[model samples]
Each structure stands twice: as C-alpha cells, then as structure tokens.
Target: MAAVPLQEWERGDKTNVEIIGYGWRVLEYFHAEEKRVMVRLHLPADRDKDRIQLAVMLMLRDIKHSRKWLCEFCGAPARETHTFNFFYRVLDSDLPRLVVYCHFVCDMDKRHVREGLTATHHLMNTRFDGTLGPMPPFASFGKRPSGKVYPLAGSCAGCQHEDTAVDEGVLKRCARCKMTRVCGAACQRADWGRHKVACGMIYSVTFENWG
Candidate 1:
C-alpha cells in the first residue's frame, strides 16, 4: 500500500484518505502543537499488517509508550524486557534524541556500540503474563562468537570461497559496504562490476543519509 501524505491527513476528512482494503483503520486523529498530527492506526492480526504498523511507527517523530510489547531490535514479541539508552539522530533536529529500547539484549545483539559511547543497562521488573513461554533463541540475537571456532569471517563475495584465517590480513572488507569480504585485490576487482550496485544500495541505506 502507498503511504498517505500529511496534507491528506490534515484535510480532517476520514473519507479523504483511503485505507479500506489496506487492512488498517483510523481509530483516532488529533492535531497537536508544532504542526504535528497524530493518527492512531488499528492494524489487523496479521504479520504483514504488523510490519506495516512498525514502519509507520518508525516514521513518526514523537512516539509514546504503548502497552504492546515488541523487541526493539528484532521487532518480535518481547519476553524478557530491559531498558537501553541511546542517542538517535533524526533529520529534523541537529541534536540526537535519547531513545529507550524495551529489549536491551536485542540491542546488544545488533552490535551498535560506538567508539566512545558505552551503553548502560537497566533491567525492567516486568514479566510476560501471556500463554507464551520463554523467548526462543534467535540466530541473529545470541552471544558473541569467540572467533576461535567460527573466526567471524564471511565468504568471499567474488569467488564464493569460504574465508579462513590463513594470515592476519587474509580477508579485507569492502571499503563501501563493509559487509562484503574479499580475499585479495584481484578478487575485489573481479567482483566490482557485479557487486557495485548492491553495495551502493546497502551502504546508502545503512550508513549514509538516504532518508
């Protein structure tokens, strides 16, 4: 579904905006100060609908706490909860905003640690009262690899060869994406034609200001 513009929402007519077949309903609408408009969306009980809701929430400038529990990192249902404090830079403001993560362990799993910033943890005294049991182990959210057994290396993007630590500088990451690993300059040069598009897309979205 296409995203509705702010002008359409400001029209103050519920029928002016179309969301009939989009599996979402407008529960409430309010105009706040500072030219901010609040629209409460009621999403259906579907996975895709939930994802749409999450995307909408992320675009909002000022978000308040809700009763729905979601993992800040993975967007899954939160079982064990903790609070994390981090500064998030937005387009509207020069100063970064202090944001709190409901699931602090998920934040750690993403490896978002900066050079000088250290994250302080505060455990929330909340427990899941639903029928669901303890949270399952996620592949992306787990203890850090020792690098002794796994070595924390990726396969060569060009040759598709499994990177092994034969020397200290065996595999070097691509300067742009930093995700693709190349065995040597020759492999990187060979892969440039095919890898450039994907690399640019990933790097722009992840690192650069493409918002």
Candidate 2:
C-alpha cells in the first residue's frame, strides 16, 4: 500500500490491513506543516536469499543530492523490525512528497551493517524511488551548495575494496610516484617503482592502470 498522511498517528488512518503486495508496504505520519512516509520493501517474504538482489535494486535507485529520501524506524535487539524514514513536501505536491530516507535495523551486527553499507553505496549512484535507471542532473536547493563528487547511486566495480580514505590522515599516496588516488592501497603499492619514473605520463602505472 502507498503511504497516506493523517492529522494524527494514533487515529490509525494509514494503517494497512492487507497482506503485503508487490514487494512493498507503506505508512505515513503527518504534523501541522510536514509529512513523513515510510516504505518497507522486501524482495520476497518467502525466502532470505533474494536480499542481495533487493539490495542491488535499492542501491541503483539511490540518487545523489536531489530530494529523494529514506524512512527509518528504531527498535531494540538484533532481530527486531527494520525501520526507514522518508520526508514529504506537503504543500508542494498534490498530497505529500517523500524527500528523505534512512534505514534502521535493531542492532549493528556484521550482516546488517553490510546490508546497510551496500544500500548506502547504492544511494551514492541511484536516486529514483522504484526502479534502476539513469539519474537526472541535480540542482541545488540550499544556500551553501555541495562541492563534492556526487556520483549516481548504483553498483560500481570499486565497492569491493577498502575505502582509500580510511582513518587518521593515511593518504592513499603512491610512495614511488607521490601521486594521490581514490582507489585502494594495494594497487598503489604494486605500481610504486614502475610508476615513479613514469609519473603523470600515459605510460605511468597510476592506480587507474594498475590492473
């Protein structure tokens, strides 16, 4: 069911009474000026193996810097319910518009954290609500605009390795070549001596060509 806004949450106006359909469920809460919409989606309740595929889909739909959002709900214990949060622009749309989103699982178990990270990685590349597709160029809405690389949220070959920017000023610099990189450290170390003399040249073994 799609989310619906209510004057008060206790009134149960957005409560759903039917079995989940189309791998989705939705709920809503509203106050005087804004609304919140929450959607719980699963690949198929019948099994757990489909989560990876579900994650890929979720990741591919995450867009950078636009108004899309995630909804979150908090709970206790490791096995409790997963919650998400989404914001809405009540005055801007015909009824409400979901704008922000977050995911809340009960605890920080490795599996759950991995899922969360995967979803976040996906968000970096995708931004639509329900499908995997190309994202549109984003326009700034706030006073101080962001000046960072806002990549589309989707699967990239780079997600498997450790983040190059990990911990206390440990720059991902090639020792031999003295060049900076966003790719992981292993690639940098491998090309050190060879890259030193070839630095910044086409034949240089930069991280991009380490493979």
Candidate 2's clash total is: 27
TM-score for every candidate vs. truth? Answer: 0.25, 0.19
Model 1: C-alpha RMSD to truth? 17.2
Error of 1 at 49 (Å): 16
For residue 187, what is the lDDT in candidate 1?
79
Q: In TM-score terms, which candidate is top?
A: 1
Candidate 1 lDDT over residue span 1-211, tens digit each: 3533444222222211111101111223462111111223322323243443343333221111111222333433222233222222111223212223322122333443211012222111132132123333345344545542221213455564433323334567677655455677997899788666445433111211111
Candidate 2 matches the true fold with a TM-score of: 0.19
Note the Cα lDDT for every prediction shown: 0.32, 0.28
Q: Model 2: per-residue lDDT, tens digit, 93-160?
A: 33322222333233333354446535653574465353423322122212223443322111111331
Q: Report the CA-based lDDT of candidate 2 relative to the real structure.
A: 0.28
